[model samples]
Every structure is written in C-alpha cells, then in structure tokens.
Target chain A: MQGIILSNETNALTLAELPKPTLKPGQCLVKLSAAALNRRDYWISVGKYPGIQPEVVLGSDGCGVVVDGPDTWKGKTVLINPNVNWGASEQHQSSDYSVLGMPTQGTLAEYIAVDEDRLMQKPVHLSDEEGAALPLAGLTAFRATFVKAKVTAGKKVLVTGVGGGVSQMAAVMAIAAGAEVYVTSSSEDKLNKARKLGATAGFNYQGAEWVKEAKSVGGFDAIVDSAGGNALNDYLKLIKPGGKIVHYGSTTGKPQELDLFRLFWSQASIIGSTMGSDREFEQMVAFVEEHQIRPAIDGVYALSSGVEAIERMADSSQFGKTVIRMEA
Target chain B: MQGIILSNETNALTLAELPKPTLKPGQCLVKLSAAALNRRDYWISVGKYPGIQPEVVLGSDGCGVVVDGPDTWKGKTVLINPNVNWGASEQHQSSDYSVLGMPTQGTLAEYIAVDEDRLMQKPVHLSDEEGAALPLAGLTAFRATFVKAKVTAGKKVLVTGVGGGVSQMAAVMAIAAGAEVYVTSSSEDKLNKARKLGATAGFNYQGAEWVKEAKSVGGFDAIVDSAGGNALNDYLKLIKPGGKIVHYGSTTGKPQELDLFRLFWSQASIIGSTMGSDREFEQMVAFVEEHQIRPAIDGVYALSSGVEAIERMADSSQFGKTVIRMEA
Candidate 1:
C-alpha cells in the first residue's frame, strides 16, 4: 500500500510503501479517496507538535470507502472521526485520548484500518475533498462556536484570523446558524473572501484603530479566537457584558495582557477548547449536511505531490483546507 | 446623623455629620448597627477604584433594623444586599448595575435608605457583626463557587489567597456545600485559620514549587482566585481537565502569563465575576440560613475608628472581614 509516512530514516514526511493493515474485530478497512491538511499536520511536520512518532501516517482528515466491516458499515462512503479514545466524559477528553495522525496511525494512506464506530456516512452534499475537510476543522469549529460560546440566532459573533481552516469554518457555521458573523484578518484578500461567505463585516487587524472601529459598531456576543496575546485585551474591550470568548488555538504563543477589570465588570468568560468529542463530531456532520455547507478548498495535490500541500500550509498563505488526492 | 464619608475637602474618608436618609416610595430606612470593609472600599479610599465620587458613604456590607417602611417590614432585622440596580439578567449584571458604595450612597452611614427587595432577613445564627460581614463577600463568593464553578459534593476546590474576606467566604461556602476544599496562602497563620474553617489541606504559596506540591496531590475541579497575574499560569497547571477558574478580583493588577496549550487541551474555563446579581444575593443569604453559616469577622472597630479599619485592610493582613460598629 502507498502511504504518506513521517520517515524515521530521512526525518521527513515522504511517500513510502507500507504493509496493508489487517482488520481486527469491529475494525474496518478504509480505502481513502482524499485527505486534508490542518495546522496540526503542519506543526507535526515541523517537529513542533507533542508525541510525534516516526513511521506513522500523517493525516487526521479523510474521506473514504469502508471495504470490510459489519454489514451496516461495509461498502459505505464515509468521513473518519479523528478523535480517538474520547472516553466517557463530554466535559473533556480522558487522559488517554489522542488525536489521529501522530502517535496513532492515521488516514493519509491508500488503505487504513479503523474502528467501525469511527466512520460516519459522508454528507451527500459534499465531494470527497470537502468531506475530508469537514472532520477535524469542522468539529473543532462546531464545538468552539456552538458548545463553548453557545452561539445562536440573533447573536453577533466574531471569528478572528479568518484565513485559517478552523476559523473559516467557524465563520461559515455561525453564519449558517443565522448569526450576525464578523471576521478579522491581516490580509485584505481574506477579509473580502470572508465577506463573500456571508460575514456581515470584516476588520483588517493590521489597521491601527481596528479594535476601536469594531467597538464603535457594537460589542460581539461571542468571539472565536485563535491568536491569543495582547490582542485578547482588545477582545475584552469589544466583547459585550456577559459575552464569551472561545479560543481553540494560540498561534501567537505569548502571554496575554488581559484586562481583568473589564473582564470581571462585564462578567465575560474566556473559554479554552480543542478538538471536539465523538458526539460533537456527529453534530457537526449533521449540521454540514443540513446546511448544505461546502468547505472552502485552497489547492489540491496528488498523492505523489503531498509534500507541496504541506509546504503551502507552512507558509500560512492558504485561505482554506489544502487537500491531497489518493489517485494520481 | 453620623457617617463614614469620602470627604471631597480632604480627599480622604472620615467620620462626619450628615442628614439621615429619607425613604422614597418602595424604599425602607434601615438604622445600620454594623458595616463591614471590602477591598472595594479600600480602593475607593485610595482613589484607585473607578467612578469614585467624593462625599459618598463608603461601605457595601451592612446589617441593621428597618426603622420605617411598608406594613411588611417596619421593624425587622435585615442584612442589606449591596448589589443595587442589578437589572434583569441572571448571566451578568445590567449596564446600569452598581455596587452600593461608589456612585450611590452606601451602608457606612447610621441610616441607609434601600429598596424593599434589597433586604434579606438576617440569619438567626449570626450576630450584627457577622451579618454585616456576610453581604458583599458572601455574595461574591457564592457566585464564584456555586454559580460559576458549579461546584458540588466530591468536587475538589481550591481557594487562593485565603486570608481575604471573599476568599475566606468562598472556602467556607465550598466546605459547607460538601466539597473537599484546599487553600493557599503566604501566611501560615491564615492557612491554619482556613483549615479550621474546614479546608482539607493548605499550601504555603510562599514556598518554592508550591504549584508542583499542589499538583502532586491532585488537580482541582474548580479554583477560586483573586490574584490574577503569573499565578494564573500555576492554576492552569493545577486545574483538572474541564475545570473552572472563577476570579472575582485581581488585586495584583498585572497581566497573566497563562499556559494556553494546557488551557485548550484541558478544556478549562476562566470565568470573571464581581458582586453577584440580586437573585444570587438572595440565594446566598438563603444558603447561609440553610447551612447556619456565620461569616468570620476579623475585628470590630468603632465607627469613629473607621479610618483605622481602612488602614488595616490596606495592609492586607486581616485574616477575615473587618467590621465597623455604629455605636462608639
């Protein structure tokens, strides 16, 4: 079988011939049609992610066909749930929980073995590329927006760093849920693109008076953020009383100069979230199907050119998910 | 009438002669027997609090007997709810919300005019001094513990800076609610006092590696904190997955070096709260009555010596609430 593996010998991710995985009880063989890149994959490739194991397949998002499993799952087109060992608690993941692709062998392969329960029927409205994009980023955005922030209709929501996969998904989902969605981006092009996707407005964060401008209009009921640093203080200023700031990633990697006075006085909440649980994954897929949501695709690469897809992600210029086709 | 007023002439708080408050429709005149000091009062005295209006009375917590009101309560013993104009929302206070001290006239006067709804029956278990100590600190602690953190039986709770009024009240309330409570303090004397109040354990935060020591025992399901500088990073490390860090004050007045990675992966929430809403104040008083909980009073000072009491609070050495008796 052909797979994209983080090669121990070369210290790089490369296409290599690997043995086909044998199915255990309750396990199914998935012939992956497409896979997608996330910031998690980029971090792992750069050796910045924790618990990186060599020789493991390197994708958490995939759309595939189940070749061997119980009668209910056999021959079904599916999107894989990347969350593994989610355990019992809906409040948080268990101690043993791990995402797919690093420590556990993942889905960037021609043939991958997965538990039957990890497979969900691919949304009929989506192509294989879009289906692949919908698992990890979709679930993450869904949980952060819906569960953590409790974003609903008539609420105003802000999605920061709108070019990223999860951030874009959050903006799209909030808009789909009838929210007044706003976005921020350093790139004017990304801001324009977000506006075309039904964002009520876009703020160019590079502007000197962006926070002031944002506050001038009105405060947001919820702010979905990935960049967490001095910018968080600005969020404290812009969030309404009793608003929620839900952060899934801290791309800036610095301490926050949060204004505690504003926070307590306004009774704001700063919540931290990551990838969602299995139940959230199901809800995300259902939402995508019901809304007929099409994921924004950046560029697609063939299996042989998978390295180029990761390079595009590393430069941080891609506006959406970069995908890899299994067939050349 | 005698009152402790923030005198505009001297730019200081002093005992002065003032006209007794007259009742408005739906208002009651309460003859205050005792008033308690909070950090808010100290901040206003030093011109550190926002919206400091000179000539205003400078206390929020008070216990008194209603001298004149409607037929419902003309001669009832009561503890005044310092949370005024709390408005509608249970999630957060309204924009018009203000604690009783600052811009509005407050409880330090010999007579206070309050809305009928702002009065709660003083618990039979408490004296005038203890009832005065219970309103502001008790409401803030109740909101942080039961409302924000959702603490319950078998939960492990940590109360930081346990010597302060609100922190001590939080420790007591969590203990009364059947949580296994731990406390942190730089003073061994304060830690011993907290343990006597039913904390399961105490950590001397002055000791090097205090965070490590706290983590060695186990992570806390909820941490009630007031000091929100770099110590917040320590709380992130000590919090269990899905834990809540509820902060009501930030006496340190510094930015936080929070661990974003730990925060997101653990799925923790950092909630900010000030004085609770009217409903929460009512609930707090009810909880006190149900538990027969008496607030810990540090010292009783005569109203003429209120300046000395403020100085005691300014030094931050008081082990519990400092009360001022009206009779000298």
Candidate 2:
C-alpha cells in the first residue's frame, strides 16, 4: 500500500510503499477513497507541531470504504473519527488521547486500519471529497460555535479568518442553525465568497476600522475565532455584553493582552474548544445531513501529488478544504 | 448625616457631615448599622478605579434597618444589594449598571437611599457585620463557582488567594455546595483559617513547588482565581481536563503567557465572572440562608476610622473582611 509518510530526518513528507495493516478485534480495515489537509498536517510536515513523530502517515480527515469490519459496517461508506483513546468522560479527552496521523497510522493511505467505533456512515448527500473534509474542520467548528458558544437562532455570530476551512465551516454551521452569521477576512474576494455562502455580512480585517464596522452591525452574540493574539482584545470590544468568543486554534500565537476589566465587567466568556466529542461528531453529521450541507472543496489533488496539496495548504491561500484522491 | 466621602481634589476619603438623603419614588431609605470594605474601595481612594466620582459614599456592602419604604419594609432588617441598575438580563448587566460606592452614593453614609428592590431580608442567623461582609464578595463568589463553574457534589474546587474576601467566600460556597474545596494562600495563618472554614486542604503558594503540591491532592475541577498573571499558566497545569478557571479580578495584572495549546487540547475554559445579576444576588442570599453560612469578619472600625480601614485593606494583611460600624 502507498501512503504519505512524514520524515523525521529531512522534515519533509513523501509518498512511500508501506505494508498492509493487520486488523485486530474491534478494528476494521478501510480502503480510503479520499483524505483532506488541515493546517496541523502542514505544520507537522515542517516540524513545527508538537509530538512530531517521523514515519507516521499524515491525514486526520478521510472518507473510506470498509472492507472488513463488524457485520453492520461491511461494505459501508464511512468517515473516520480521527480521534483515538478519548476515554470515558465527555468533559475532556484523556491524557493519552491522540488524533490520527501522528504516532499511530492514519488515513493518508490506500489501506488503513481503525477502530470500528471510530467509523460513521458518510452523510448520504456528500461526495467522498466532501465527507473527508467534514471530520476535522467540521467537528472543530461545530464544537466551537454550537457546543462552546451555544449559538442559536436569532443570535449574531462572527467567524474570523473566513478563508480558512474551520472558519468557513463555523459560518456555515451557524447559518444552518438559523443564526445571523458574519465573517472577517483579509481579502475582499474571500469576504465576498463568504457573503455568497449565506453570511449576513463580511468585513475586511485589514481595514483600519474593521472592529468599528463590525460593531455597527451590532455586537456579536458569539465570535468563532482561530487567530488568537492582540486581536483577542478587539473581540472584547465587538462582543455584546455576556457574549462568548470560542477559540479552537491560536494561529497568531498567544494573546498578548486580555482585558480582564472588560471581560468581567461585561460578563463575557472566552471558551477554548477543540475537536468535537464522539457524541458531538454524531450531532454534526446529523446536522449536515439534515441541512444537506456540502463542505466547500477548494482544490483536489491525485494521491501521488499529495506533496503539491500540502504545499498549497502551506501557502494559506485556499478558501476551503484541499483534498487528495487516493486512487487518482 | 455622617458619611465617608471620596474627595475629588485629593483622592482622599474623609468622614464629613452630609445632608440626609431624600427618597424618590420606588426608593427606600436605610439606616446603615454596618458596612464592609472591598479592595475596590481602597483602589478608588487612590484613584486607581475607573469612574470614581467625588462625594460618593464609598461602601458597596452594607447591612442596616430599612427605616423608610413601602408598607412592607418600614422596620425590616435588610442587606443592600450594592449593584444598582442591573437591568433585565440574566446573562449580563445592562450598560447603566453601576456598583454602589462609585458614581452613585453608597452605604458608607449613616443613611442610604436605594431602590426598594435592592433590599433583601438579612438572614436571621447573621449579625450586622457578617451580613455586611456578604454582599459583594458573596455575590461574586456565588456567580463564579455555582453559575460559571457549575460546581456540584464531590467536585474538586480550588480558591486562590484564600485570605481575601472573595476567595474565602468561594471556598465557603463551594464547601456548602458539597464540593471538596482547597485553598491557596501565601500566609500559613490564612491557609489554616481557610481550612477551618471547611476547605479540604490548603496550599501555601509561596512555596516553589506549590503546583506539584496541589497536584498531589488532585487536579482541580474548578479554580476560582483573582490573581491573573504568569501564575495562570500554572493553573492550566493544575486543572483537570475540561475544568474551568473562573476569574473575577486580576490583582496581579494581565497574564503574560497563556498557553493556548494546553487550553484547547485539554478543553479547559477560562471564564470571566463579576458581580452577580439581581436574580443571582437573590439566589446567593437564598443559598446563604439555606447553608447558614457566616462570612468571616477580620476587624471592625468605627465610621470615623474609615481612613484607617482603607489603609489596612491596602496593606493586604487582613484574613477576611474589615468592616465599619456606622454608628461608632
């Protein structure tokens, strides 16, 4: 089987032939159809992420066909959960819990083995590419916007960095939940694209008065943000009293200043959310199916061209998920 | 009428003869028996607090006799809810919300004119001094622990800076709610006092390995903290996965380095809580009544000795609330 392996020595990702995986009890062998790239994958390849294990297959989001699993899962089209060893509690993941594509093998291969419970039937309306895109970014956005922020109908929501996969999904999920969704992007083109995707409005964050512009739209009930830095202070100004800012990633690094006075005085909350729990993943899939939502695909690459896909993600110009077709 | 007034010119607090306050419609006049000092009062005296108004009687927590009011309240013993103009929202206070002892005249006066709705019957079990100590700190602690952290039976709660009024109240509230409460304080005497107040254990934060010592007891399910600085990162390490760190004050100033990686990966939450809503104040009073909890009073000062009390609070040596007896 051919898989994308992250090299520890050279700090590069390359396609290599790997032995077929043996499935133990409670595990299933999956023939992957497609997989998607996340910013973590690019970081891992460049040796910028923590726990960078060399020789590990790289991909946390994938869609595949189950060839050997429980009677119920045989021949089913499923999406991988990516997260493993979540343990018993729902409040948080266990200390040893890990996402796929790190120390353990991942779905960036023609054949991969995963726990049976980690497989869920792909939403019937989505294609394999879209299904692969839904796991990592979708679950993250779902948990951050809905679970952490508790976004609901008539509530105003803001998604920062709208061109990113997770931010786009956050906007989509909030909109599908009947929220008035707004987005912020550095590029006007991306902002327009977000507006076309059902956002109530869009702001160019590069503008000197973007915070004022957002405030004019009315203080957001919830702000879904990935960029965490000095920008976090601006969020305090744009948030309605008692509103929440749900952060899943800190791409801009640690926040330099969090206005403690504004935080407590306005009764605002800063919620840190990551990938969804198993239950939340199920809810996300159900929501996508019920709404017939298709994750936007920015570009697709053949299996042998995985390097190109990773490079594109590194460029940070893609507006949506970049996918790799396993058999192309 | 005699009142402790914050001077506009010198930023000094001095006892002065003032005219008796006339009650307006929907207002009640209270003859304050006692009032408690918060750190905010000291900050205001030094011109460190925002919106400090001269001639404002500076005391947010008071217990007194309702001398003039509607048919039901003429002779009742009541504790004034220092928070005024809380508006209608349970989620957050309105724009007009102001704490007593600020721009608005407060309870340091021999007589205070307050909205009738701000008065709640004092718990029969408490003396004037104890009841006076309960309003600000008790309300802040109540909202932080029960409302924000949702502390429940058998849960582990940590209250930092345990000697302070809010921290002490948090420890008591969590204990009364059936939680296993721990406390951190620099002074051994303060820690011992907290343990006597029902903390399961106490840690001396002055020690180099305090985080390790706290971990030996167990990971905290919730931490009520006022010190927000580099120590906040240590809290993330001490908290159980999915736990919350509820902050009401930033006594140590803004946090320099917030570990965003640990925050999201562990799904930990940093919640900002402040003075409770009117509904929350009622709930806090009800909780206190049910638990028969008495707020700890450190020392008593006469109304004429208000300047001394402020100095004592500034020294940060008191183990609990320092109160002023209005009639003295």
- Best lDDT among the predictions, by candidate number: 1
Point out where model 1 deviates above 4 Å: none
Among all windows of 10 consecutive residues in model 2 chain B, the one with the lowest summed lDDT is B6-15
* Residues forming the 10-long window of minimal summed lDDT in candidate 1 chain A: A254-263
Q: Please list, in the order the candidates appear, how each scores on TM-score for chain B only.
A: 0.98, 0.98
Candidate 1 residue lDDT tens string, B82-191: 88788888988887888997787888879999999989889999999999999999999999999999999999999999999999999999999999999999999999
Reference-based lDDT, residue A259, model 2: 78
For B1-328, candidate 2 gives per-residue lDDT tens digits of: 9998877667688888999999999998999999999999988878789887888788899999988879799899999997888888888888888899878888887999989989999999999999999999999999999999889999999999998898889899899999999999889999989888889889998899999999998799999998887888899899888899889999888887677778887788888898889999999999999999998889999999887888778768888799999885
User: Taking the tens digit of each residue's C-alpha lDDT, what string does model 1 give over A146-225?
Assistant: 99999999899999999999999999999999999999999999999999999999999999999988998799999999
For model 2, what TM-score is found for chain B?
Answer: 0.98
